[model samples]
Target chain A: MDQITLYTWIGFSVFLVLMLVVGYLSSKKMKSIRDFATGGGTLGPYVLGFSFAATYLSAATFLGYPGWSYEWGLSNLWLFLAIIAGGPIGVLMVAKKVRKLNNGQKSLSLPDWLGDFYKSDILRVGTGLILLFNIFYIAAQFVAGAKIFEYLLGMSYTSGLLLIALIVVIYVYAGGALADIYTDAVQAFIMAIAGIGIFISGIVIFWKGGISDTFAGISHELAAQNENLVAVFNPESLHFYSIGAVIGAIVIQWAFASAPHLFNKVLGLKNEQDLGKMIATYVVVAALSVLVLFGGLYSRAALGDTASAADLALMDYIIWAFPAIVVALFGVVILAAAMSTTDGIFVSISTVFANDIFLKFLVKRNIVKVSDEKAEKIAFQISRLTVPFIGLLALLIVIRPPEYMGDVMWIGISGIAAGTMGPILQAVYAKRKAPARAAELSMFVGLGSYLFLYFTGIIPSTMSAGAVSVFIGIATINIASWILRSASSSEMGAAEEGGS
Target chain B: INEMLSIWLYGFIIALIIIGFSLWKWYF
Candidate 1:
């Protein structure tokens, strides 16, 4: 429509080309399935660290969250704290153990890690089924990113979604984990700069020539409407201050430690020492990302509650206040967030299906009839082929997403956390192994109860289904483990010491 | 300005303390 909008599109097109170039460069020199899946376990701390951060903050953080934060004010900081702490804190607690286990198992994927740890092909298949929900997960990121483009170009939502999905599939399909990790590192840098730019832009809008300006605290319009808009905690809601909110934060954030796509970066580290450095780098970068979180506060302060969709709160403000190029670059930041997340999810899902489900579970007793090297070559090809196929599957599922998402999104997330976190923690920390059946039952009961209590409204929506599901899963697992105690401790040392 | 800043500052302090305690307990 305007010259600036045209310039914005030109910048985005250049950015997309740059990303494709990175994908091409990373795709070279892949000798094995290991390279495709885990970057051959040779990625350094910086690459893996930024990759973790980029994938951890998805399109939701970029788009949906700020608008939610805009309405709620400082209460939104609780969610912000969750985002900054989730991956860093999770890694600080568990990454060393993850790397050590990687050494013990040489796991190509999280499902592989779980299967080997529990020694159950059935559990691996179950984990794979749970992760298949990445179709929605990938689409969730796509939807968030597309919403920004939808606003920017004034196009149909479907067109933006299709454009993003195609870009994610192409790069990930071509370069695998190598491309994902490297591009994620670059995306993290871009996001940090974009976040700072947004914060400064918001701050400058309120600037005045004299000693003081009426726009001192939130927008003049918002503060005029309700002075509580500037209050630290609007005692009525007590959002960030509530006990349930804090606990909910912990439960959802713990999923960072449990998610396959997020932590699979750890499985790609060059060495244990690098893993420690990765934690520090990841934490610092992600924690500092709070700058972007302030964009919502700025948006609310700059342009108070509007009739626009809550997700568009910040973007709408940016569109009105900033030049077209700044808005367009911000769009790149959103795309980076979505693409970083989608690429990782793509790699995780495709590799899980190819490596864990097809090769390990379906190849007749985890053994293929060929030399180890030849089997690995076939596995590599299968994983590469599965990338596009997995992308297509995700594309198809996302084509007709549920109109009423209901509790399905949160339920699915909590189920994944409840299902995997309990079993994985025990495998790494428990002195004695729980029966595989107990592990399997924990997943089913966890996922099932989350949906059941969730759908039945047994647990109030105020309380997280994830936290409830996790406790239920733990309870069921503890009882099951105690009752079905095995006499032998043969699998006791799987992820713990003495496994080899 | 101070009130809004104080609230967010408190949230950040509390979150950092949690991380501090965790790092000490796990790594120290």
Candidate 2:
């Protein structure tokens, strides 16, 4: 009934209508499970590029990360720098190879690509199971969306969560990956605009004379509040306390580039030729998107002790800095950021379940035998059905959301990155086939070591723990492969000598 | 203050250079 709420409703309604229209159009194009999963491998460079960047940016980038900047100060920028450099590099290392590999097999999902490449059903199913951790990441997005709705529209957290879940589930179920990609591209554009707006608003609020003066003034204000706040490596901070921790952040972010939802964007590109253009677009957009982090430092300087909770810092700043109409429009952009990632996650999780677990594991093994046509139909239906099922699971977690949305999301991200990064990198780049046993061992080591380090507080931060685990995994695979190869060769030599 | 500012500036400069080199080598 208030002006802000009224405008927000109007803006959000328009966004929802546009998204549903795209979903409806895309639904008509889904003739097979592959079409539902990977947009029939026909998306253009810009669409896939934007979708990849948008999915990576998410509410964490806009809402959660700004809060980190507000809480921890300039030290948080190291993580941002890591993402800027690591993301494109990760994509460059994998995208063209992934696209070429998938072209031959027409694999519909990340797990499917790995499983087929390694020729192991166990690897496919194991990776599929590991990716289910994305449920936690999705729940974190819901918490973010609910927080924005609670702040902007004065809706209860529960109502906001339910509304976001309902909207995302309906569209993704109807249109699948095609709809998710197109909407994600649009969302990425809006997020880019909002990112610029956030950065400029910080300058507009705190312009002393020029850019240098503005930054110095802000730094002085923060140092006045707490000298540790402006430190490049704040000793009190958990995430960026030491040089080791900063390097850990970079390594983990590089590993995150291999996450299923982000990496699988390569599968939708029309061909390898489009890859350079796609990666170029993604790098530019991602570079722009992270500019929103400056809002954190700005809010910290402006609000001082009165700043809201860490996750709420950016939202509170937006409310305080802008007028009602701009606030309302920003509300839409924030929702786009949250939904963009959530929908991509939904598509990725569903594809893993239907394609990797159900079709490949069960039908291929005769555990659920059926004619190929019937099996495809069942898998497609199952994939569509999975949207609401996982949405409901994630909704349950959001009902009792964690204290830090960003940290909670990283719990899942760290696990997936640690487990998959080693095997995936090796699969894409290795000249000789990595032993399937080595891949499996590396996954367990990566995941197990990450859990041990995280829970025991040895590493003390999820990103650091995940980074160490990734190295352990890569090392495990190489050692195990070398040992196995040597042993087999020795056995062959011994048999030849005995025969002579 | 100068130290902090320099670190920030240099951090970004190094990151941009790495990204630029990567783009040229792999993407361009």
Task: Give lDDT tens digits, candidate 2, residues A419-470.
Answer: 8877887877776777788888888988899989998989877888889999
Measured by TM-score, how close is model 1 to the native structure? Answer: 0.82
Q: Cα deviation in Å at residue A386, candidate 1?
A: 5.3
TM-score of each candidate structure, all chains considered together: 0.82, 0.90
* Position A385, candidate 1: lDDT: 82
Show the colliding residue pairs in model 2. Answer: none
DockQ of candidate 1 is: 0.40
Per lDDT, the best of the predicted structures is: 2
Off by over 4 Å in 1: A25-44, A176-178, A207-216, A219-242, A258-274, A366-412, A455-463, A486-500, B1-7, B17-28
lDDT of candidates 1 onward, in order = 0.65, 0.79
Q: Could you report the DockQ of all the candidates, in the order they appear?
A: 0.40, 0.52
